[model samples]
Target: MSASPAVKALGWRTPLLVIIAGCTIALLNFGVRSGFGLFLEPISIANGWGREVFAFGIAIQTVLWGFGQPFAGAIADRYGSARVLAVGALLYAAGVALTAYAATPLMLNLTLGVLLGMGLAGTSFTVALAAIARMVSPERRSWALGLGTAAGSMGQFLMVPLSQGFIAAWGWQFALLLLSLFALAIIPLSSALAGKAPEGTGPKQSMGEALKEAGNQKSYWLLISGFFVCGFHVSFIQTHLPAYIVDRGLDPQTGAWALALVGLANVVGSYTAGVLGGKRSKKYLLSFIYAARAVVIAVFVMMPMTQVSVLIFAFCMGLLWLSTVPLTSGLVAQIFGPRYMATLFGIVFFSHQVGGFLGVWLGGRLFDASGSYDVVWWISTGLAIFAAIVHWPIDERPLVRVAPAAVAAE
Candidate 1:
């Protein structure tokens, strides 16, 4: 699909601007969310609640984010991403601010779980990536997606430390308030993504048609299945890794640094994946990433517990973390075209968040029961292997409707 007339009117500079704005949104959205793990201990201790109470709130957030994504994406696909992002920003800020005052589990669930989740659905990767996909040319699309993902990584890296420092300097309540301000920044930035998807030279299909076509594709199902593993792995680590590290008799700062290291290393990993995805088989690349994740987990668990090893594990996992995002999103665009990229990818992301819910919730349950994260860690490793195998057979060819006439005929 071609970019909207208004987008084209701005000429070459438009693409660059869109990328910049998309990256900023991604950074703020992911950065703020990634640091939630840092708050788990403080919130639980303050409220005299069990870890499950806080974990369940985050779990609800993940599931609602998934459930809300398709609707948010559909709205963005029909209206404009700008509107979706603006609403998301408002809700996100409100949710974060209210979370600071939440004394009960139900309050936390409504504010952090439901409202924040819905806000994330509107403002995060699905919306931003789709907008960027439409703004750039086909050849550069993967790179653009990678840049956007890396920007999110940059946010995670920068924000994690900042979050910890905030909590240390002030209090968890003030830290949440400060982050709400960051969420509010998304409102003005959303303006940059205004307008509909760029029109394609070929006849456009309705959203229903796109949905039906994706439902019938084996590759799409495979992508959904594989992405679930990514969600599980990332959510579990992001929500529990800090505590897991602390449980191992290390300082809380060690966990923060580990997460920051993951973010830092992922910047390189995500960008490289984007660059490589353009030139290589994205499916194979995804397969390799999942496989490598299994290996990393295996090694980390086997080695002796030490600060050096933990940081190393974080760095290695970081390399594999979020590396799948650009490739997976690019695959959806490559197969279905960018016209319905957000909606299609949002459906895929829904599966990711399902895994996220289980990952985060289960970590808390298993830890509370067994007093260790070992079982969940093993489960993550196994899921990674399963994901690796599933991604192997996905068809990467463009859809028939998007194919050239001669190619379609052939």
Candidate 2:
């Protein structure tokens, strides 16, 4: 069908609107997740719980977030990002409110684990990026994905200090309440993602089919394995960096600054990565990034534990942070097609969260048992190197060719 005159005139506007909505969603979901570290000390201390108890909540959150993601993505793919996001905002708000009052481990687990994790599944980058991918042309999708992820980092940059200040001024519960309000803000922004269907379309693939397809792909397994390493590295650092700094006799504020700096620097790194990934082999770029992280960690650990060294490490490490996301997601779209991008990507992300659960939970447990994080840090460094090696030979082309059989089956 020919374009309507009104639609033709607003050519660039549609893509721009989607990109803006994508970035907004990214910022809101990630900004809050990024600040989870700040609540660790305060919440645990207030409740007189062991660090592992709170870590358990975070671990539960990670695993459940992974578990819930594909279903959320399927819902978004089937219904629309708006409806999924609206529901996520409501769940996130309720979870945060309940978290503020959580006195028992079971309560913390329910609030942070089931509720908040599922909320993230619905409203987080997977759904937003899929929506943006569908809206943009193939050529621009990589860079567009990068911008969306960068926006998430920018959220981290904005929210870390904001969270810290809230904790200082009002208290942890109040701070959580403030963030809950921010989560609700996604409601209005979600309207920007609303749109009618394109002309006559065949039935969409069911979520079960997408999951089954992903399960059968060799490349998908590779992606999931590599992403596991990413989750382990990222969650370990984000969840424990503050405590690590405090344990090392540095001021707690420095840890917050380190996290914020990482977020600030990641904005640039993610954008540059996106642009580069579009032009070059995204798989190789991701490998190089993972390798760079290992080198950075080794150097950081070898250096004297001083303020300047920590900051330098944080900045260098931040540049490598989330650079994998664009390449990984791009690979998923490349191999699986965007028809079920969110659901497939959600399956891949599930591996990441599994690793995240292990990373955060083990970080706390090992610290309590051994009184040190050396083993976990070294283990993370090794996994990064292993992941870099694993990504070296990934064929970027589509894994399963859609032949007549596939089309008819669909």
Candidate 3:
């Protein structure tokens, strides 16, 4: 088909097409990365390295991804998302493709760590949701964010099995090369998300002004702190859960299925959180999610390790997994407005990456030293409670940008 026909079908900037294309981008981007844990065992075994080697590489990728996203979001906010995503697609493909040949820890860190990290930063949820937030009206924004997040979760659910199959049918190296092809697909989908955020009628603000405005807001920092916990919880689980399962004497396939279950259940949780965010108090909802995660994690680690118990834990965890993303991002958009959603949310997301760095690195380091994930699980539980406490006091209402005189006239 000609470019014109496809563009016409996508309706270019139409809200529906934007949502559709954005979700697909999210799916492809998140799905491929979510499966990286599957390779941890095999890669370590093949290289005769410890778990820490692969874990550290992935931790680097996570931190780099976190570090790079803010700049990526700023560029998308100031210029447009398409160009950033296109470049990200190229980097992502190169990262995955080149990672196949990485025989040493240093090589893995560069290919899978730095390159993949930067690539993911460019093509990540920060950009996709920002584009969706700009394209749609406020009324639909939360739902759209939820849908996009759910699509990413769906990608995790679907891709884990496919990634496993890739490793099974071909070697892990070829499987990664196959995934690189999927990364390339993001280049085309990004076309629909082109164009800068529409500026509002308010006084023009430079990026510095925007950052300053957000910096002065206490709730913004609270969001940042809470999100850091989120990054910690998910990254630790995603990178280490499979190996954790194996260590616990379960089948390795059980770990993969558990991850798939988390993704599957998150679809419902994310969408529900999105729908509820449009109506309920977002801070309260956030408080509840973190608290609930604490309860879940506490119960999960304490429970026996069996296929049934693992699946049940996965399902429960899935419901809570990404439910936080839409709500947190929605809060950022709600408090600050959508014009700078990408940049502001990108900053909040950076905290998440910081947590991810600690989670992944700590998981490897602690386990290598102590031969247990018990301490990390306890740390995750404590952080969840801390996040719950911080979010409870956040000011969720929108800033009153209008003057008193103008407000009285209205």
Candidate 4:
């Protein structure tokens, strides 16, 4: 009895703990921000400004998110995610809180655009997924990434209604201030995700070498191209769909619920894609997703506008939404190993944000010009097809640059 070994207790640094913390961070980061679309009408009217002002601020945010991701990711990859996440949470909270006081478009851009964008880059998918990827075994890596993604989608689902309630109860400004508090929650949770995998582990390739290798890979660029479409589709729909629904004479609440449905369905879709990515070909699944997106968007546009149609479209689109994330990140980890996943995936994510910038800003511009979202809708459809076709040619196999001995040395 005395000789019997004591079972090991799970430490705070355990993979499970890391994943739980990371997922919670994802939830808060995505959840608090997902409902920004709901603010467009109220905020714009309050400022006596046109939609472009708000849209431009959001567009700047999108681009800044992309621009900051690579550097944030590189820092996370080299140092650790905890510090990056902590700093991001601070920026996120400050941005949201300060947004309540913004009186001009310039102020809006500074708070929402630069601060919020930078915050999201640190707390969003690339950083979280890369951390989870390194924490779990390869066999469970994809599944864990999906779990993290699903957590983020859950936030999107749950937070939109809560955000709406906040706006309904308080004014929009106070609502923003209240939500800013939620962003601060990420600070404590970031502590559990403190380990840095790249300092001494794995291949000793410099960041530049890793970038060079990925740059030479055709599949990597294909993934980037396809992900850009995902950004475009998501940003456009999330930021403006509520207005679109209102324009169609539907209740604004209908638009909110529609976005929530997308988030809810995304939980299922993201988890399923992650599990499937572990077993199936990531490229084929991606191709199918993009192709399906094109068909879904086309059908939704052609159909008459109704609350039911919008809800249905949202659900369908939600299933395809963040589902691309786990698979795409998995492919990056699969091809490159988990060493520099944050840096590599961050670069891919940058392209996505670029698309997001275009999608959101152009939606406002085009709608303002044409008095209809028709042109943007068609552009989205065409981009979906392009993404679908591009994913088909990606070589899903892992890259092998050196002999076995060299790899062992690495």
Candidate 5:
């Protein structure tokens, strides 16, 4: 089919605007989630709760977010991303507000764990990425996705420290209230994705069919397993890395900067992965990325402690961090097509959350019991190697389906 004049006329402006909107939404969505780690020590100290209590809440939030992701993605796939994001913004705002008022662990868990997690599922990458993936052409899809994910990382980098400053200057509750207000900014950006899906392009199969299809695929299982490692590493690091640093006799600010640098470097890494993934073998690249992570973690653990060394480790690790997102999402698009992209990706994301729950919750449990995060770091390093191996054998190809229309059509 010939390109329409309108499609030709879109130039870079439309995609740029869409990408900007996607990045903005992602920044706000994941950024707040990333900052939740900062509240652990302060909140526990103030409320007279044990560290594990608040950690459990955040861990529950991670699992709930994963559980809610596919549903949110299905909603975005069926309805549109804007509606999902708009609703998510409100839900997120409410959750944060309620969390500020939480006096009991149950209240905290309900507000932060369930509400905020569900809110993020709606507004974060699952929705924003699916929206942008649909808007761009295949060749540019990875690039655009990388850009959006990078923006999310940038948000984490910029906002984590900002969150710390907020806590330092104003107290945790007031800081959360301010962050909640900042999250409201996503409402306006949500409009950019309204009515963006191409006409007549949607899920070819019902959710049941898609689930059955994915369930039967070996590659799908591999992808899910690999992604679970990604979640485990990320949640473990984000939730506990700062405290680990403090325990190591380093300043908490050092951990904060380590995270920020990871965010900053990921912007470059994610974008590069997207660009390179378009040209190279995405599965192979994903495998290599995971393998590299294992290597980096090993080196970091063995190296003597210094601020300079830690910063370098953070930068190298950051590059491999979210680089998986673009490749994984791109592979889903390649395998299943965009019609069921969001829903399929959401299922994969669910596995990731399961891992996230273990990572966050177990890290806390182990720390309280053993007085160390060493075992978790070793576990994370091992999982990275396993993830790399899992992706290596995945057949990156489309599934054959029985034609639904007419037999002769095939």
Candidate 6:
């Protein structure tokens, strides 16, 4: 099929607009969600619920977010991202607003878990990056994705403190109401992503063909497996690190700042990963990132607990945190082509969220049972090593169908 004249007419400026809009959406979506950990203690205390109740709600949120991603991507791929994002914005706002009234575990799960999770699936990196991927040239795609991912980190850095402040002044429930208003901002931003998927220079393949091809690839599964470790590490730390810090006799503000530092450092890490991915071996980079994560976690666990150590850990882990995102998503695009980038990446993201579900849930359960987070920390360190090993053997070449016809002919 010939490229549309409109698609052909889209230039660098168009992609810039798309990237800006995408980054904004990512910042807001990820930013708000990242702060949920701050509310863990307060929300639990208010309802006289166990930590497990809050953890389980967030775990369900992670899982549902994972499960919803591909469908959201599929819908965006067919109908356009704007509609999906619009619906997501509404759900996000509603979920946050409704959570204020959630007095039971079941209600919290329905509001925060299902609604917010699905909302994030539509508005977060998976959908936004995919749309940006379709908008830019292949050479520029990695960098664009990195920017979007960094924007989420930026959101984390900015929003965590803001969330803390809100909770401090207005209380958690009122803070959520304020956040609900912030989520509504995505409605206007969705307009920037309002076009059909750009026609690519490569041969066209049906969505079914794309899915089947990805399913058959060993490297694809390997990527998915590695991503699971990322989800596990990140979800656990984000959800529980603040409480852990507080339990260790530090101020709650220290924990909040630590999370903020992770976000701040990750902005640089994510952007660097994106830049390097365009030129380097994404799989090797991914392997190195996982290995580094293992080392960092090991060091953090062994060192005496102190404010200095906590901040250092947060910075180091922050640098490693979400750096895998660009490399992983870029690898998918590199292997499968951007035609199905959203759906394919979403499938991979589901694996990550499965690990996330386990991570968040297990952290709560084990901590409740053993009265310490030591077990989960050690487990994360081990999983990082496992992920590093898994990523090392992934074949990073593009699929034959997506390769240039000359290369395919050879």
Which number leads on lDDT? 1
Find the 10 residues in a row with the least total lDDT in model 2. 195-204
Model 6 TM: 0.95
Judged by whole-model lDDT over C-alpha atoms, candidate 6 comes out at 0.91
lDDT of each: 0.93, 0.85, 0.92, 0.90, 0.85, 0.91
Model 4: pairs clashing at backbone N, Cα or C within 3 Å: none
Which residue runs does candidate 3 get wrong by more than 4 Å?
Answer: 1-11, 402-410
1-410 in candidate 1: lDDT tens per residue?
66767576756448778889999999999999999999999999999998999899999999999989999988888888999999999999999889999999999999989999989998887899999998878899999999999999999999999999999999999999999999999999988888778668766678998999999999999999999999999999999999999998999999999999999999999999999999999999999999999999989988988999999999999999999999999999999999989999999999999999999999999988989999999999999999999999999999776445656788
Tens digits of per-residue lDDT for model 4 on 1-410? 22211112224477777889989999999999899999999988998888888998999999999999999999998888999999999999999999888899999999989899998988886798888887667899999999999999999999999999989999899999999999999999999877676342454678899999999999899999999999999999999999999999999889889989999999999999999999999999999998999999999999999988999999999999999999999999998888889999999999999999999999999988888998899999999999989999898777765655786787
Candidate 5: worst 10 consecutive residues by lDDT?
195-204
TM-score of each: 0.96, 0.93, 0.95, 0.95, 0.94, 0.95
Flag regions of model 4 displaced more than 4 Å. Answer: 1-11, 198-202, 403-410
| Stronger candidate by TM-score (2 vs 3) | 3
User: Of 2 and 6, which scores higher on lDDT?
Assistant: 6
Expressed as tens digits, the lDDT of each residue in 1-410 for candidate 3 is 24433335445477778889899999999999999999999999899999899988989999999999889999999998999999999999999999999999999999999999999999997899999887666788888899999999999999998998899899899999999999999999999898887777565667898899999999999999999999999999999999999999998789999999999999999999999999899899999999999999999899988988899889999999999999999999999898898999999999999999999889999999999999999999999999999999999888767645677888
Task: Show model 2 residue runs off by greater than 4 Å.
Answer: 1-13, 195-212, 399-410
**The best candidate in terms of TM-score:** 1
Query: Across residues 216-269, which tens digit of lDDT does each residue of candidate 5 receive?
Result: 889989999999999998898888887777777888788888888888999899
Q: Which should have the higher TM-score, number 2 or number 6?
A: 6
RMSD of 3: 3.8
The runs of at least 3 residues in candidate 1 whose Cα sits more than 4 Å from the true structure, single-residue gaps closed, are 1-6, 10-13, 402-410
* Range of the 10 consecutive residues with the lowest summed lDDT in candidate 6: 4-13
